[model samples]
Target: MHRRQNVRRALLLVSFLLFPVTFYYLSPYLIIMGAGERTASGSMVVFGVMTLTALVLGRLFCGWVCPAGGLTEALFAVQNRKANNRRNWTRWLVWVPWIAVIILVTLRAGGIQRVDILYQTDHGISLTTASGMGPYIIFYAVLALIFVLSLTAGRRGFCHHTCWMAPFMMIGRGVRNTFRLPAVQLSADTPSCVGCYACTSACPMSLEVQAMVLSQRMENSECILCGTCVDVCPHNVIRYEFGRPRSTNPVRPEKP
Candidate 1:
């Protein structure tokens, strides 16, 4: 395996192992429903952190630490087909209404009264606190939806089209872009691509990385910055950068 592949796999495995404890922190339903309450949920705190981090790192969390991301990559052994990029916009259909409802519910409940940060979560962990079948039902449903979607889309389909968590990070990344803030992203050198088409095939997100390089628009909202291209490139034509990428010169500079 390539170095980047190994590194990513290690990260993926760790996140997967930690998922049982981390699920509630990333729960969208908990955050939204708890929005109309006196005490806030852990998901809300995580949401705030995620959006803020997206402002600096884009979706690096997805590439490096998300449990769903880890699971999606793990399932690649079972179904490695590329995803259909079309209709990715459908996620927005779910996202907009969800946010609207959250806002409405909070308003109906009269804004936040206090911050509990531990609401609903059992001892700030999930596995030990639940004693009923309702939580189990929701847990299994979430797992079923993720696996079913991944099977259909061939790669992290839920992340692309159904994840309720992605929109907040996306919104933060958009804000970063709009303000031209110092953000971590990938920059590429298209002229040095070697025409091998390796990057595109290697992309787990099913992105046309070659096209992004050629067009000089290296940033993609769906890019997890897993560094697969950076690892696989024979010519080392792409790299991860923080803040104001040069946005030019696909060829590497020759030594004098």
Candidate 2:
């Protein structure tokens, strides 16, 4: 694994431990590391922190700190080859919950009374913004699917195209390009690249790394900062830098 990947693993372990403990032992919302406090009291604080982190760090948290991301990465590692050839029918199974949550939340937000057909719990509430079943079942299902998919797909398929968290983080990454963090960079010497397409194929996100090398447009909004390109670069052309500026220069390198 690369350095950023190692960081992601560490964050994943901590997040996994934290999620259950927070839900059962701490608040139902799992805001602070404290006892249960109803309403959005502490949970809002946690949400605030995550939102703020994204705004400042340009999706760095997604690649290096999210448990869901870590689980997906692990799933991709299982097959090590031809992971994309497989598809998870189980993802369709998950859509039931996803749509149900969206409907229930929309209803609740619009002040419509719900019959509770799909979910049964004393906890009557919205799922989308809440720290309840909105995330709980979704998180579990995503984890399981990642593992199952890994046996076939061998790459971060779920995260690349379908992560719910991506929209939130991308919002931050879009406007906050001014604050760059450490990332792998392509060098001016990239012309020496032999078009092996190793970097592109290595990318769990399916980003066209070879094209990014040639055009140097660095237009990598979909990049999850997984460092696949850096690891696959044989020419020693890919480099890492800390706190660089976003470039109007087409020669600018793609990160992660």
Candidate 3:
């Protein structure tokens, strides 16, 4: 477990370093704009790829690699408070409407006639072609937004409330759950949990880990599969596994 914590920390640092470059090239706002300019935008392609990846791997992208995740993790040093994510569902309001607009724009554009992975990217890098301080100002503004949310609302507040990227992954994860497909996930042996709350304390997303451990339900859509609960458990109560879930929805037969 200690080993896993060390590995996670290393991965977090690498992700933080990659964020500036990643956001410049793959910013969601730009991607949203591209959706109307053309049918199959590079941002759309990336979103599709991310969804497919999440279908197989769950939210490991959020846990291990999201630039926003990296930023939030870095900010935890300054403010290590737990987040109140009860309003997380409100993100769907923003996501659903934006997705509807994307569809409307694509239809208005007469469908995807061409594919260009580098549509918005300037020479394959977003920062390289910035004309003036405008790009930098926007970039810093984004950073400040994330930072301020973390400082005021708690860990990953931006993720819970404002991120445009997470909803795509969450929807993909929901598809996995609905199909009961094999994916990377955490499972628990509830008998082994000591109820010490260590796992809860370590969770960056501020989930009620003890409740999840107690209920033996590690399948929450909000879970990023970061494995902090698994790592902090002195009792080895939690562990990663690959398998299909026994969905609560029962399969029904058609009328004969």
**Which residue runs of candidate 3 sit more than 4 Å off their true CA positions?**
129-131, 246-256
- Model 2 lDDT, residue 17, Cα: 48
- By TM-score, rank the candidates, best first: 1, 3, 2
lDDT of each: 0.81, 0.52, 0.77
Better of 1 and 3 by lDDT: 1
Among residues 3 or more apart in sequence or in different chains, the pairs in candidate 3 whose N, CA or C atoms overlap within 3 Å are none
lDDT tens string, model 2, 144-249? 7656655544566665434444555565555556455433333424556677787877776666777776675453656666565777677765554444443533
Candidate 3, 92-139: lDDT as tens digits = 887888778777777886777766776755666555556367777887
* TM-score for all models, in order of appearance: 0.92, 0.58, 0.90
Q: What C-alpha lDDT does candidate 1 achieve relative to the native structure?
A: 0.81
Candidate of highest TM-score = 1
Tens-digit lDDT track for model 1 on 1-256? Answer: 7876798888888887777777778887877778877446788788888899999989888888888888888888898888988868989988889888878888888887777676776776665645378776777788888899999976888888898888888888989888889889898766667667788898988999877877778878898888998888889888988985444544443332
Runs off by more than 4 Å, candidate 2: 1-19, 22-38, 41-44, 80-139, 145-154, 178-189, 243-256
True-vs-predicted CA distance for residue 175, candidate 2, Å: 0.8
- Model 3 reaches what TM-score against the true structure? 0.90
